[model samples]
Target chain A: MTLLTVENLTLEFDTDEGRITAVNNISFEVNSGEVLGIVGESGSGKSVTAKSVMQLNPSNSVYSSETKILLEVDGESVDVLALRGGKELRTVRGGSVSMIFQEPMASFAPAITIGAQMVEQLLLHKKISKAEAIKISIEMLDKVGISDADKRFKQYAFELSGGMRQRAMIAMALSTNPKLLIADEPTTALDVTIQAQVLDLMKDLVVEFNMGIIFITHDLGVIAQTADRVAVMYLGELVEQGSVRQVLKNPTHPYTQGLINALPKLDDLDAPLTPVPGDIPSPLERPPGCVFHTRCALAEPRCSESIPQMTNHGEGHSAACFVTAEKAEAL
Target chain B: MNKKPIISCRDLSVHFPIGGGLFERKQFVRAVNNVNLSIPQGSFFGLVGESGSGKTTLGRAFLRAVPITHGEINYSDGEKDYDLVDLPKKQLKEFRKRAQLIFQDPYAALSPRMTIRDIIAEPLEVMNLTSSREETDELVREMAHKCRLNLEHLRRFPHAFSGGQRQRISIARSLVSNPRFVVADESVAALDVSIQADVLNLLKSLQSELGSTYLFISHDLSVVAHICDMVAVMYLGQLIEVAPTRELFSAPRHPYTQALLSSIPNLDPDHQSDAQKLKGEIPSPTNPPSGCKFHTRCHYVVEHCKVVEPLLEHPESSHDVACHRWEELMNIKEIPVANLA
Candidate 1:
């Protein structure tokens, strides 16, 4: 069953100059107990779309008429966009759908103790007393491999190491037992050794909790390791969505192909970086036709004149591009 | 190859006095201790370590950004030689001209108010490298072009650029000085993987074109592996081992180096579990262990390793390792962990 469904989602920002389309019309569904990786470069609207699902977009962001997000909770479906303000968002934000940021320090309060913040969150979401909440928090901390849990519980965020702090944040996020965990570039800040450890822990947590996850990052290698399904976003549009193996092994979209080509593989150190020839056009000056047409190497006159809809190629494999899969492969 | 070493450090250490009051016994936080490195002329040398390893301090010590507390630092370029620890103020200024640094965060390094052209030309103006305004502009344009920055974008401020473009500006500013040596501390760490490759390639090409020596410092071993000709592994400010990049990755001598190399997440999905993950965090640098710093977490650490400090000993071709039981450990069959298949 689909745990969350986003349809015709459109988000705009009110800049000083004019209304800028940040996330153009996009639609996708995440099933229960599946990891979906959103791959894109900067200004690709991947982050904006993820934030929109939680209604965490800034005050200046203007939602278009077609924007709709339905969350299936306890066999009932409700529009997530209909919920307004902190009071209503609390049930969905941290209680049902938790979010972990890229930088652990940014999300964590430096002044407050990790234990204090974790217990406070537990108390707010669950009807638990202070003592019980503290116990669970410590247990969760231990589960994440933070040594001397009780001692660390009293220590402030600044005292813990980078790896420790990230683990603590994960523990705090898991303490609520949220069904949908949104990890945004979570391991990007960590060292390689620590990154491997954290990735291992996250993979284990997903299996134990059987939770659906939205893993957003620019690292294709990392996404390939963890995500079961992958979605490629470009210039505020969902360019492609399919299983990790299918999409990664045989990407259909020209933009997706370019992104995969650009990535440096460890197996082939000699491969020169063939970057998509142009820059990501600023959101204010988005291309008139296809968003990726400006950068697509195989782009034709028709591609520059019209936007292509997502065309299905195989089971759950779809892409938005003028060229066919075989033609794109030939390139 | 006949040119003298660009930078050489012997038993170099950078320590900070912790605990206040004159009467109180001064405890030192040895950020970098007993690190010996000889960076040859025009060589791309990599310094690899995690946090609290003193790689940043060592980089700063080359530029005299941080004070050298102990040992000797000898810098020479065939034409001249100067002791970094004892250089006079006048000579230090000249030394600054010879050695420059590039910071990691492009966002924080460049001033938002200054135009890209002005940002790149600031070093030339401040150091009086160029006499006329036109000369400075020419040099800035040259460096910017070398860094792949569009000439049109040079007129705009840093905020107008992306992370990759801003980093190019930072690179241009660092290279505009025409320094013989450059210390790049995690220059590509903040960038995305693809962008990182682009920047790394730019840096590599710059080194070749300018024929300048680089002290490349980073936490990412894969990057260091691919780029640097020589690799030095540091643990708590001490040089644990130094070897050729391919040799270091293929056959690491020190246990710490071995663990670090194995931990790098490869593109292959199958080989991640086979890595021998290091246990425990780096000990507090303020009150470091008296003996080998890595003994606390080393799986094969013996009693002797905890009691006596091991010096960097040469056992192979230009390869140096600081460990008590390296030979014995090397003899034992390695546990077959998943290789990055």
Candidate 2:
């Protein structure tokens, strides 16, 4: 079943200069027991889209009238964008959906103990006693592989190391048994060994809890290791979406190909680090047709003239590129 | 390994004082613990390690940016030999001319108030490398061009430029003086992947043009493999392994190096990796492990490993590893590079 669905979600931020559309008519669904990896560089609007699921965007963020965020919980459909600040909205925020940010230290309150924060969030979300909340929070901490969970409960965020802090944040995020988890660059700031450990922990938990996860990062290698299905985003546009095997092995879009080529792959040691030519255009001056045409090597005249629609290439694999869509049609 | 070592370290260490107050007992965090290695002239030397592994501290120790507690770091580029440990005012000033540093964050490295041209030209004026203002401008513009930055944007401030362009400016400033050795501490970590490749390529092209050595310090193993000639692996402030890129990747001896190499998530979806996942986090540098600092997390650690520290041994030519049972472990063919299950 689909745990969450976002359709035609367009987001615009009203700045001092002008209203810049941050997310341009994007849509994706996260089913329970699935890990959907959203891969994109900076300014790709991956984080913004994730934040929109819980209506966490700033007040200036204008969502289009066509935008609809539907949350399915216990057979009840909820229009998330329609929810105002009340207990009704709590069902989606921290009740059914949980978020973990890239920097664990910044996500937490430095003044509060890790356990206290976890208990506070749990008490707010669930109808449990203080004692039960504490007991369950410690269990969650132990589940995430933090030893001496009892003692660590009283320690502040600064007391723990970077890896430990991240794990604690994960423990706190999972304390409520959230149905859908939005992890935005959770391991991007961590060391490689710690990242491997965290990735393993998350993979195990997803299967155990049977919860959906939206893992967002710029690393293709990371996406390959963790994500079951991958979505490639470019300047707020979903350029490609497919299974991890299909998108990584047989990438049809030029931007996806460029990103894969740019990475320093360990297997191919001698491969040159070839970056996609040209800079990502400023948000104010978004490209006329395809957002990636300014930098795409395989861009044709049609790509510059009109935006390409998402074309299916068998087995649920899809890419929004006129060049690839025409080739697939020709075949 | 045969090329002349431009910078050499002999038991160099940097211990930082931590939590020492009038009432509290004075303690030290051994950031760079007794590391001995040599970087060949005109080669991109990589130092790889996790956070708190002292990679950055060791990089700064070579540049004399941080004061060392013990041992010597010598610099020799076929002309001068300066003892970096005890350089006086005159020699220290001259040493500053030959060595430079590139910081991790481009946004934080460049001053926002300064123009691009002035930012690049400031190094020359500070070092007194150029005689006149016009000479400085010419060198700055030439360096900017080499770094792929438009000369027309020289008059603009750093805030006006993008992340990639700002990084290019920082690179231009570091190379304007034409330093013989550069310590780039995670220089490309802040930029996007595409821009990172561009900056890395520029660094490579600059190396060929200037014939300078680079101590490329980063936690990223793949980027190190892509550009570096010699790679050293550090764990909790000690050099565990040092070898040529191919040798280290192909036939890793130390369990720590093997685990670190295997931990890298391969881009190939079908490439099965029976990679050994390390058990715990890196131990605190404030009070590291007794013997091998990595023995606490090493998969093949023995009781003896916890007591006796192992010295780095050359089991093969050009490969150095600090492990007791490296040879016997190598004989046991359970694991190898290109680890496919």
Candidate 3:
């Protein structure tokens, strides 16, 4: 039931200084009706990985020959990375797989009415008349919980509130009946209450539509609330991958443990925050061995000399850390 | 807890005029409206709110960065007292040395052109706190070390540092002035989670070392819960609730406070509290709703809430709420903590 499988995704960007690896041989899969949360900080390449799924990376991006992004569409497997800008690409971009950004305002055209944009998007993918497209767009808007759909449809993006605009973007993205939805920090720009509302809406939509979502965000709380499975990334590497409960409650990797510990818990107010020591190394100056070895508390001497392979810890929980892998093996 | 307040505001209000034309009537955007609070000496006081909640404006008003439209702000440091609203020109410049601000965005706060050393020492030189260049450099170096920045980093520009490093530099610059009062407006908001904790710990340690009073303004509730001694919740530029941090989190009186607390996404995946989520966006400040500003969004809102503006009622020694039905709300038996558990 795997909707998309991204294997050995080594994406490098050609910078003026040199070619820098942004996502280094990362592998993961998104299954049907599943929420795969990609949790990471600034330089984790979570966004780059998500972008690769839609082939949306900039022209400077260089994917390794071994890199493979396979998408299952209508019982047929298609190589997503091989797609160039055309009707076929459009089908993958907005037809089957849709993307939403942190800033909904940026994705939408300010000059055009939301209704026009939604209708235009529908027309682009679906072989339907303008009238039929308009009907579907309004229905989609109403589906995402935008009140007075007909009125809101006529108004431009600027006329709507932040939450409403996000909803509109979601509605547009969903209007195409996209199989996979890439939500990149969808709720980061929103207020807590608004965020809660949006999260609730997304959860409801996922259940109703049974769509696979690749939720990318830095907020662990949001990930814990929404995601079924989680992937922890650091410095363009997948440091850990497991079910949300397993990863959150019993994280084996020092980096994962550090990230969880760093968060301020409302339930346990007295616990002192222990931040992961040192800053994330810049992409240009990526550490030689395990990228996290520089800051990891449990890092051994050997950790600084070799990259750790992903070791299975019971069920689907896997961590890429030499010490943790050894500990798991011992257990 | 009984220490004298370093800063206190009495019916403070900050307003900016908008759209004043020959034919059109002049109107004011009530940024900070009638906020009354006190920051006790050496206590980390938190101001929590949404974007238009006036928390930033209130902090700015305290630092005299924004013009006060009404009421009075008083600053006292156990020795000297000054009415900040109408201080003399010379005294105002002197007051600058006593109070300082730490901005949210580390990337923008530090001047990219200046070296880390020059940036940290600029405050001291402007205030004329140190007499010689060597004295300034020594003070800068000491502050930098205290902030956990390497002495070698002093020569590099801000562009060379990461977000966390730049934030440390910003903190060093703010603290180098030896200010008694520091207004930190979303100081750690820009930082990553791990780095945020580091900066928060540093701030806590620095506060203890210098015994400086902090008016920590942030939109983040969890962060405020971790750091602040006392918490105040603002809605539409008005203070709706104020209580001790523990009490406020444990048992919030105002419905707005309750909704806000419940809305915070808990880390526990299994524990989804059935707390009522608030509806609608904050009303526009230009044409705010009459009476209670939060009435439109409050779940327990009644007809009385729409027309009658409830004044802040001191129900407990440490707790204050502006809700008319706070007493009745409290009288209800405690909701099961099972969801939270």
Candidate 4:
């Protein structure tokens, strides 16, 4: 069953200058117990799309004709987009879904104890007593490998290390046993060793809890390790989506190939990073044709005029490009 | 042949006292404890460690941003030698002009209120390296050209530029003073993978042209492996191993070094799940374990390893290890570099 389905999601930001389209007509589905990786550049609308899942966008964000997110709960579909206020959104925000952000420090309250926050979240989402909530929060912290859960329970966010704070945040997010977890650059702030540990913990939780996750990050190396299925986003569009093996090993889109090629290899230090030649077009001056046509080496004149729709290439693999799979193979 | 080391450290240590009270003696956090490093003239010496490994503190000690609690940091550029620890105010100002620092965050490092030209020229004006405005502009333009920054962009503030361009501006500013030794503290760590190469190449080219030594500090082993000639591994304020990049990767003598080298994710499909995962976290530097600091989590720790602190001993020319059981563990061959490829 599809745990979450976003269809024709178009979001525009009404700024002082003019209307800017941030996410443009994007659609994807997350199944139960699936880890979906959203890979993109800095301004690739990856975070915006993930944020849209929990309705966390700014109030100034403008919606187009149709932007539907159908979240299935208890065999009933809920129109999450129709949730007008925090009261209604609260039903899905923490009860059914939870999010982890890039900077743990920013997400956590500086003055309040982490345990209090976790217990409060648990009480808000579930019908549990204070004592029970506290017990559950401590267990979750222990599960996440906090050295002394009881001692750390009373400590503020500033007292914890970067890795510890991140773990605490994860523990808090998972305390509600949310069916869907939206993590946006959760490990970007931590070092590689701690990142690996957190990744392993997340994967373990996904198995133990049987929950779907939307992992958003700019690093493809990270996506490779955690994502079961991957989606590549470029400049407000979903360029490609497929199983992790197919997407990573045999990436069909030129942009995806360019990104993979651009990554510096740890083993082959001699190989130079072949950066896609041109800079990403500013969001205001978005190109009419393929969004990636400006930097694509294999772009044709046709690519500059017509926007390509998503086309299926193989099992669970699709790419939005005018170039055929055979031609892309030749490149 | 003895032109003297461009930068040398003899028992360098930087400690921070925390938890002050009557009951507590104010225990010291040994940020950089007993660190000894020697960077030859024009050599790019790499410092590799995870966070809290004191790599940044060590780098700052060289630049005099952080005070040296005990020991000596000697600086020599063939003509003059200065004991960096005991430099007088007049000589310290001169030393500042000779040694420069490249910060990690280019966004924060470059002033948002200043234009690129002013940001680059500020160093020159502050150090009194140039006399007239035209001379400053000429040097700024030269450095900007070398860094591949557009001359027109120099009129704009750092906000107008991307992370890569801002980093280029930062590099240009650091180079404006014409420093002999540069400490690039995770300079390229914040950049995109595509831009990291460009910045690294620029650093390499600048070194060749200027004949400057770089104390390159980064947590990314792969980035260091590509650019650095010699690599040093640090764990809990101590240097565990140091060797040529290729030699260290191929045959890491210390267990910690071996674990770090193997922990780098291999892009190759075959080596995905087989990468040796490092167990546990880095211990706190405030109260590090006795004997070998890494013994707490070391897989091969024995009774002797727990009781005796291992000294940094040379195993080969330009190669050093700080583990007592290295000779015993030498038989356990490291993961082949070709396997990752």
Instruction: Identify the candidate with maximal DockQ.
Output: 3
Docking quality tier of candidate 4?
A: acceptable
Q: Global lDDT of each model?
A: 0.86, 0.90, 0.92, 0.87
Model 3 lDDT tens row, A246-302: 999999899999999999988778889999999988899999889998898887889
> What is the lDDT for B208 in model 4?
91
The residue ranges of model 4 lying beyond 4 angstroms of the native Cα positions read A324-331, B1-4, B19-24, B268-270, B333-341
- Which CAPRI category fits model 1? acceptable
Model 1, position B168, has a per-residue lDDT of 85
Query: Which of 2 and 4 is ahead in TM-score?
Result: 2
Choose 1 or 3, whichever is better by DockQ.
3
Where does model 3 exceed 4 Å of error? B333-341
> Candidate 2 residues A1-331, lDDT tens each?
9989899989999999899978998888999999999999999999999999988889999999999999888899889998887687787789999999999999999999999999999999989999999999999999999999999999999999998999999999999999999999999989888888999899999999999999999998889999989999999899999999999999989899899889887767888899888788888889989999999888888888898888899898999998888887898
Question: Candidate 3: interface RMSD in Å?
Answer: 2.5
Each candidate structure's TM-score, on Cα atoms with residue i matched to residue i, is 0.93, 0.98, 0.98, 0.95
DockQ (C-alpha based) per candidate is 0.38, 0.60, 0.63, 0.44
Alpha-carbon RMSD of each model: 2.6, 1.5, 1.4, 2.3
What DockQ does candidate 4 score?
Answer: 0.44
Ranking by DockQ: 3, 2, 4, 1
> Higher-lDDT candidate among 1 and 3?
3
For model 4 chain B, where is the 10-residue window of minimal lDDT?
B332-341
